[model samples]
Target chain A: MRADMIPLAFRDPVHDSQSAFRRLLRALSRPGTPVSLPGPAEAPEPMGGPLAAIALTLADADCPIWLDPALSTERVRRYLHFHTNAPQLADPRAAAIALIGDAGWLPGLNGFHPGDAPYPDRSTTLILQLPALTGGSTVRLSGPGIETTTSLAPLGLPNWFWPAWHENAARYPLGVDIFLTDDRAVVGLPRSTNVEVP
Target chain B: MGIDLAFDDHGVYSFAYLDEMTKRMIRRAILKAVAVPGYQVPFGSREMPLPPGWGTGGLQVTASLLGREDMLKVIDQGADDTTNAISIRRFFARVAGVATTERTGEATVIQTRHRIPERALTEDQIIVFQQPQPEPLRRFIPHEVVARKLHAFAQYGVMYVRLYEDISRLGHVAMSSDYPVIVNGRYLASPSPIPKFDNPKLHRSRALALFGAGRERRIHAIPPFTDVKSLDFVDHPFTVQHFESCCSLCGAQDSYLDEILLDDGGRRAFVCSDTAYCAEQRGERTKS
Candidate 1:
């Protein structure tokens, strides 16, 4: 794709970043609940609105971001680099934030850093691109933020994802937290949540 | 003359005071706090307009979290009109231009010090607690390095032993306020300075409770429906303060009251600590 073809960043950087950050906060606090992104961001080809908004809001010069093989294209790289100014990391394990564009071809959950017990806050935050936020296999989630049991149907997740998620949840205070993004909405699945998929 | 504390110098402060990057960092830390439930997430807490130990922690959080649409409510010791509350409310109104409210129900975000509202909160509400001390085991273990090691292993035996020692010496657990509670059966966390009477409300509540200790540079949270158990011995049991008389102003037997002395002659009067809640109850009673 041409360099000029890439869309510009948020119209109002301050308000836009603040709004998107709050939405992401609420999404992660209440797991599996989709929160709307600020008015659609100008995204490069293959990069959706939610992911673009998140990249603009969160990724900074201090944080190093990694992308899955499919999303490591020059266009996406240029877009993120130009917008967020975040360094691109080749090693998945070293990523502070990992953008997984293709969930079906995930290279296993163990590849990423889960942080140490003493400093569990250093864990990787996975931004997984999904087909849809709803209308798929329903998974019952129970944990912090969940009152009783809440059901979420995030579409296009791989068969091996749930088992991997169970192992991740078992890590407790040390595991990668995930954000599942569709076109314009994102839902969080924190490591504390116990997932039961049928 | 006292230092001119007025911010009327017309210096262009950023929206909400903190920059976008700092807000994003705090926002990320808050998410992590909620994820871990009780584990404190360290952040680069910034110096605010006010001095330390003066609700700066809560102010930072309120600043980061405030939006144009949010209705903010600030209270100190459950009173909305106190100096701390008024100053914080005024600061936000000037900085973020958010609407300020005294009614607990009307507020979307409530920044508090030393007390939880007497009125129950719903899911839409978020309570930001100004924490002077974030560490629960700081009293038993002064060194933070040692405390971190103990927390990593979940070695809370010393905390229980302290409670046991309190029973041995003081007949009952003498600690009244700043009661420690176990969050999600994981890390033992300080629920700020809210009275033990308000501890039960922390367990599986509908509202999201966020704690910020700016001086300590730590932030933690208790998400809605999270399990929060007050630390107690099976035999000793956790108990809240009880009074023989109801609130003199609102006739609230069920509310938390602050005892006041009328004069040196020992004339005593009790009133609800949550002034707004008390006024609301009085209004309702008059209407009925």
Candidate 2:
């Protein structure tokens, strides 16, 4: 595809990105709660609107992103490159943000950077694109953001996902944080959250 | 939608005073900080017009988070009319053209130094704290390398020993302000220099709390409803300051008070440290 054929980013960059970031922040702060990203409806194949909005808001030249095989298409690459100018890295460990199009083939959570002891902020933030936000296996989540306990049943995750998430939570301050997104909404699963599979 | 490449009409400064890249950097750090509650995330701290130690950290964080629709409120030592508070409020208003509020409930974002507002904050509101020091273990262990290792291992004996030493030397825990707390039952964090009276407010707060230390180049956070336990011995539980006297102006007994010296003859009056809360109380009394 030609460079000009790539879809455009936010029309009002300053205000739009700020709004998107605020929504993302709200989603992350309140773990297990789904928040909607209202802007930028257009995206490449396999990349949902919410995920695209998140990428436009956060990914920049400074941040290195890794795309899973399903999302590693030439069209998506050109779109992200045209908008964010963020480098796409082959190594998932080196990526600050990893876009996962297919959850079934996702590697172990330990394969990615859990971050160093002193600086856990250096860890990767995984943005997984799911078919829908809910109606799957139920899991109880409790941690910093949760007042009591909240239940989430994100659809389209692999059978090994929850167990791998348990291992990720075990690392505490050293594990990668995750954002589960559908086409319209996102739910955050921070490292501090404890997931109990019932 | 085609990208609008037009420059922002908000005068010489960018939308919120900080450049887009800088805001993105701080925003990323803030997200990491929130993900790992109480853990300090180092970022490229920018050079604000205001000097260091004067709420520069909080200013940057607020700048990054502020939108045109946001209602900003700034307080210094809980007073809304103070020099620092007024200056910051004015700065944002000029740069971002956002609305400014003195009422705690009316504001969406509240930037504070040394105190949390007396009024309770809701889930919609966010609190930005100005931190001079982000590290709770800095005083106990001067070496950064050793402190990092200790945090990595979750060995917080030094902090407990410090409290023990305080109990041994004095009859009670001597720390009046900036008491250390364990966030999410993991990392030990400094709750800025807020008085012990305000320390309890940090526990399971409904509002998201973000702390920024400019000179230290660190940002940390405590998400809403997070576990923030103040350090204490099992036998001797944690306690807050008690005030026998109420606010002279509004007669608010539950609120934190500031002792004001009226004259050189040693006449003192206790008033609410939170000016807005006191004023609101006075207004309510008049209405009733």
Candidate 3:
């Protein structure tokens, strides 16, 4: 926990969060892109590395957040409470944002609301903290949001996720947005974009 | 209990829960909503402490719009004290500390469930709906693949067929809750779960309406006085329902009512669906 909170420095927190946050906006605005955020901050354990940094970037009093119960602890909750006033959600489907350290046990993306064509932008954003964030071996990506057939070498993703994401993207404007974070950085692949696994 | 000031470090979490970047993204979405007028925009939703099917999305929009001078009102199915509504009201009182009201006339913003307030809402007021499912096509096809294409191209045959199917089966469209509507003749939007009975209130409404689905990560809007139509065929047509009984609790004839049972005798009673509106009307009568 101590390692995860070292970056909440008031003197430099705003400055550091600025660059990372700008990129998150860019990533969401245009999906299926890997934009690495600079992070040396200590993220709460389980959240690990860049994902934790992203948590700091997005958590706020405005958005309600939910996390896998296994990753939640008194200290971590306390830190998050102090950092982001975001209420803890009991149901993952109701949260505006969620953090999933392990994707194996997560529910399907379809349970989420995909906004209609007249209002097609309703969906959830999931941050899956994986063991590694590589774009080479585990999966290959190609779609509207990616530059040129990008690859996501994710570590330890459940077998069901790839096909599920394919189904999610099939919804076009209405699907879950994703962010995969590991020991070093974070990469996003929104449902508007497509993915392929090798 | 000692409050910790150490976590206020700027480097960790920014002043607001969302980094300026996330807020900017939301701000951009808001601008688009304004531009399109009655369109729902897909956004990246964050997790809140509350559940999804509840008012988390409305709370998010309320949180985003709140400041030092805002008065917030939250109601469920139009009732002020329904457990979930009370919970959300208490949530804002704790987190944002904005002023709260049970009077629709006094509130700057109202977060609501199924029904709109019985009292006419003003132009300055913004009503936010806690949407369980923002996608109108979701139940029709149950296939994301089919729903998206239909929506993108405005191929809403499934919805028409479903409504027609209801008319064929129930004689009057067996729909009672969360009726879907097309806003401004272009954007197909959900009116949340507010029964078709409330459909007339959507057309030319004075208030600015916003819809948010927390779990779905989507947000949409309706500018003041916009044209909103529930999808229906010309020959079949569409209509709203009004309870024949006045409230057994409040005794108001024009207001929406809720049906409550008394005991094992199957005895039931009707009450105002909008508790605050009921109380306010009673107050007006007493004063008169």
Candidate 4:
């Protein structure tokens, strides 16, 4: 697709980003709960509305973002660069935020930065665009944000995802946080949450 | 020196005072803070009109979160009409043009210093705390490097030792405010300077709690339904302050109270520290 065909960014930058951030906050603060996200009306192929909205809301000139192979298309990169001005890094470990188009082809979680002992906040925040928020194998989540055990069944994840997530949670304050998104909604699974797969 | 026309203009400040970039930076920090639950995320703290010891941190957090639709409420020591509370409220009103309210229930975002409102906050509401010091280990270990390492390893045995020392000295925990708590069974966090009575409210709260310390250049958070356990010994459990005397005017036994000197003849009266709660109680009494 031509550069001209790339979709426009948020109509109202200030209010739209604020609204999107609030929704993201709500989703992350309540693990496994799917929350509606306000994204641009249209997005490039493979990239959905919620993913684009999150990218626009978070990515900026100061933030370094890494795009997965599936989402490394010219149209998507041009769209993100035109709007956010965030530098696309070659290494996922160095990027502050990583965008993954296909969850089934997720590169192992160990490759990404798990931050350090002192500054755990330096870790990357992965935004994975999945097929859907639900209708898959279920997993139980408990910890911060959850009053009791809550379950999530986001579709399109690999069979090894839950085991890898358990390993991620074991790192405690050092693991990368995740935001699972479909076309219109998002669900956060922070490192603090314990994901149990039966 | 001649004043520039742009500087002299009344509405020169951007919406909610901070620039969009700054807001974005702070917002990112806030998200990380929420994800970590209690771990402090350092940010670029900007200079506000208010002094550092005041509510500048809380002001910045509130400013970052504020929108045209939000209803803001500012309080100092549980009173909405106090000088600090009123000034901050008016500041937001002038800068952001958002509606300000004294009622806790009506507020979407509540900026507070040293107190959580007596009324319970709902799921939709958020509480921004003005934290003088965000690190709970600061008192125990003055060295920042060592404290960071201790936090990294989840080594909180020092804090328990301190509490034990207090118990040995005073026969009970002598801390009156600014108590240390374990957030989500992970990092140790300082819940601002709210009294022991308000400490229990932090546990599994329905509303999100965001803490900001401007001078400290740190931001932290406690998400809704998260565990916040105050430090204490197993045999001598943690307890809130109890008042033998209820409010003098509203007669509320459950609310935190403040003592007022009625005269120089050693006479004093106790009243509810939360002025809004006191007024509401009085209104209910009058109706009945």
- TM for chain B in all models? 0.94, 0.95, 0.89, 0.95
Worst 10 residues of 2 chain A by lDDT: A1-10
| Tens digits of per-residue lDDT for model 2, A1-198 | 555588777888888989999999999999999999874746778788888988989999999999999999999999999999999999999999999988876867876899998788889999998999899989999998899999999999988899999999998879999999998899999998899999
What order do candidates take by lDDT, descending? 2, 4, 1, 3
Candidate 4 residue pairs that clash: none
Tell me the lDDT of model 3 at B40. 59
Per-residue CA lDDT of model 1 for B1-288, tens digit only, reads 797777753246788888878887888788888879899999999999999999889999988888888999999999998899999998988888788989998899999999999999998899999999999999989999899888788889998998999999988888788889999988889999899899999999989999999999999999988999999988989999998989999899999999999999999999999988899988842111
lDDT of 2 by residue, B169-282 (tens): 886899999999999899999999999999999999999999999999999999999989999998879999999899999999999999999999999999999988999999
Interface RMSD of 3: 11.0
The better-scoring model by DockQ among 2 and 4 is: 2
CA displacement after TM-score superposition, residue B129 of candidate 2 (Å): 0.3
The lDDT of each candidate is 0.88, 0.91, 0.68, 0.91
Q: Candidates' TM-scores?
A: 0.95, 0.96, 0.57, 0.95
Q: Give the residue spans of candidate 3 off by over 4 A.
A: A1-198, B1-20, B284-288
Residues A169-190, model 3: lDDT tens digits: 7755556677777766677675
Better of 3 and 4 by DockQ: 4
Instruction: Give residue B279's lDDT in candidate 4 (0 to 100).
Output: 88
Please give the C-alpha DockQ score of model 3.
0.04
Residue pairs with backbone atoms closer than 3 Å in model 1 (clashes)? none
**DockQ per candidate:** 0.75, 0.83, 0.04, 0.77
On residues B32-63, what C-alpha lDDT tens digit does candidate 3 reach at each position? Answer: 45334445576767777787888777767665
